[model samples]
Target: MELSRRGFMKAAGAGVAATSLGAMGFGGAEAAVIAHVRPMKLASTTETRNTCTYCSVACGIIMYSKGDVRKGERAELVHVEGDADHPTNLGTLCPKGAALKDFVRAETRLRQPMHRRPGSDRFEPISWDAALDRIARLMKDDRDANFLASNADGVPVNRWATTGMLAASATTNETAWATFKVAKTLGIVGFDNQARV
Candidate 1:
């Protein structure tokens, strides 16, 4: 007996039919799965609109929360698409920007501050006060020892030591401001950073 295309598929298992349809570049159960998985969902709580932090072009984000803020109720973020109302990113987001929610809401985030003593092999839990105090002391010592208030010919220049301002490019504006303020307080005016002109 000869089998037609539909008869052949019906004889085979649904899985085989699905595979054959895919091979022929046709829609099947797999396509149905993709179509059903919508980006937006009717979450229980309201959404808080925010911006993505991956690049200078901040994209809009909707943070879904289910319960009271203090009680810590269930929250799930659905989509990270760009906000149409945003001036910088008009309803468009790059792959990295779209993955911001995963990064922020990950369980691997540091719960508390940590500190590793000088020449120590590992970081240990420490209070914020202790960590800040240790950092202040280290900064003071380094500034006093390496600070240079003049050029090579000692022309009474206002420049600090080259190693004074240890800056990196990945810092945000708020972080940079705090670091700069601390460095300046220690008379560390020699600024060199990843974003240096």
Candidate 2:
């Protein structure tokens, strides 16, 4: 096949016209997308790298959001998918991880800490600081009230059996170390991890 200058110019012109139209959202390029799907919502949203909180695997996830929440704006979660560049799951999500979007958007999902007073029928949302302070106070009270200083054999066995600590196993080594140190410092005898369950 012999190509002339006129034919080459015509072909190039057609290609340029099609690409320019597609760039302007004309949807004229129906054959296939170039490199990626340019019109998808996933391309327009802000991508966030996160870890799946469902289990001990700690699969890497990509969360796409629409607005800026740091400036006191309303941010909507648009999509959640496994990150291909991650090392844990390698872009594959389990049954629960696959439906993480639904989990996040579920009506019953707890967005804040809720507390129900003694004999109260329902729970009410509270500030994060208040919740943390309440928990710390309760734990301190429990430890002070029921801490065992010594055993029957006159051995110094400092233990707090009434309160327990459950740590997430998916945390990093440093976090796990810190958690263990904190629990041991608190004299917590009933320390467990989520992976064991």
Off by over 4 Å in 1: 1-51, 56-62, 70-79, 152-154, 162-197
Candidate 2 lDDT, 49-135, residue by residue in tens? 888988999899999998888878787888888999988889999999889888888999998999998999999999999999999
lDDT, residue 25, model 1: 57
Query: What's the lDDT for candidate 1?
Result: 0.68
Q: After superposition, how far is residue 166 of candidate 1 from its true place, in Å?
A: 6.5
Clashing pairs in 2: none
lDDT measured at residue 54 in model 2 versus the true structure, 0 to 100:
88
On lDDT, the leading prediction is 2
lDDT of 1 by residue, 1-197 (tens): 89899987777777887778887758676678778887655455576777675554445655655556566755555545557776666777788877876876789867578987789999899988988898778776776777767778978655446455657544457877888887776566676665553
Q: What lDDT score is found at residue 66 in candidate 2?
A: 86
Model 2 off-target regions past 4 Å?
1-40
